[model samples]
Target: MTEVGKTPWHLWVVGGLSLLWNAFPAVDFTLTNLQNDFWLSQYNEEQRAFFLGTAAWANACWALGGFGSFIGSLLLLLRSRHAVPAFLASAIGLAGVSYYQLVQNGETLKRLFGQAPLYTTPVIWAVLLALIFYARAMQARGVLR
Candidate 1:
């Protein structure tokens, strides 16, 4: 009795992690700058300038990375032929992309000269680990073959 196209519990783990790939756009789209409404920032020239510069760069990176992953995931979905390698690559690549964006995001935000928290590395590690383990299990069982 062989299982094909039927993802086990582990694959769900990977799928769940894969969902994180969409988080970038969520944050980018959901965020709302309250400064305009509150009007507390009256003549904060440096902050204003930094905000403008960072906004442009941050938006670009976030948009690109976020949208790019959407496409990448689609491509990844078609990688069923290369199960182990594809899943492994996606697990690794997602983590790498997250880290890469984290750094870029932090740098862009730092222009504000404020304490900017750009999430952490452990989250990516956890997600990637789950995905990797799931992919490994699926491969071992030939479920993804």
Candidate 2:
């Protein structure tokens, strides 16, 4: 519906990348739910907790980002700025935690991702990111608050 050649850059880059993230599991699920001693009788108390905590952080980030995208994108698409961009920026900062989760190649997710692993909800992420940016743009344009 947007006029041809009128598509926004972030619309494609961020939004499209989000979709790419959703195409796969995004990050390893086991990493978040599992502890180093998940299956072992004698698990490293510190390490186990560390890994588990690490995973939790990752999920938290993803959710944070998702929430931002949800509210921001919705407002943006609606051409409003009822919510301040500062809140959205903070949310995005928290979402950065999700990026921490990921098992790369043969490396365990408990450590750090060897490389950014494929995300589980690329399409969803893309749609969400689009909303955040859209709302931000609307605010910049003086369309809303």
Candidate 3:
């Protein structure tokens, strides 16, 4: 058991890695939403158009998913029990985004990005789920205040 008032090194490592993993998508979503031409140019015209044409609700989900995970990581690093709720919000947001992408826009995205999305989506969920469970466990163990 982790001693009271002492943080285990794994907390720092996991939190740092979670933040690092989520940062890329968060930045991409922010830059794309802002319609920054330079960043958008990284994608092909079809992909860019699809992203530009996202519905506001879907955009909100994407933003929440990306930023929420990032925020959750920060809270986890601070050993705050609030990380549990943050991660739950992130998981919900991710589910919405995933539904839109795989169900509504699947054909368009497959044509543009091929099978990459298939592989990435599962990994994204796995990591988010892991973080959520980890945070809850830490809270129950009194590691989080």
Return the TM-score for each candidate structure: 0.41, 0.39, 0.95
The TM-score leader among the candidates is: 3
> How high a TM-score does candidate 3 get?
0.95
Count of clashes, each model: 0, 19, 0
Tens-digit lDDT string for candidate 3 (31-64): 9988999998788888888999998898899998
The runs of at least 3 residues in candidate 3 whose Cα sits more than 4 Å from the true structure, single-residue gaps closed, are: none
Candidate 1 residue lDDT tens string, 65-138: 44444443333344343544544544445444454445655564455444433444466456445545655555
Candidate ordering by TM-score (highest first): 3, 1, 2
Q: Cα-based RMSD of the predictions, in order?
A: 6.9, 8.9, 1.1
lDDT of each: 0.48, 0.46, 0.90
For residue 26, what is the lDDT in candidate 2?
Answer: 25
Per-residue alpha-carbon lDDT of model 2 for 5-77, expressed as tens digits? 3445555554444444432322333333543233533445654554455545556665555444445444434
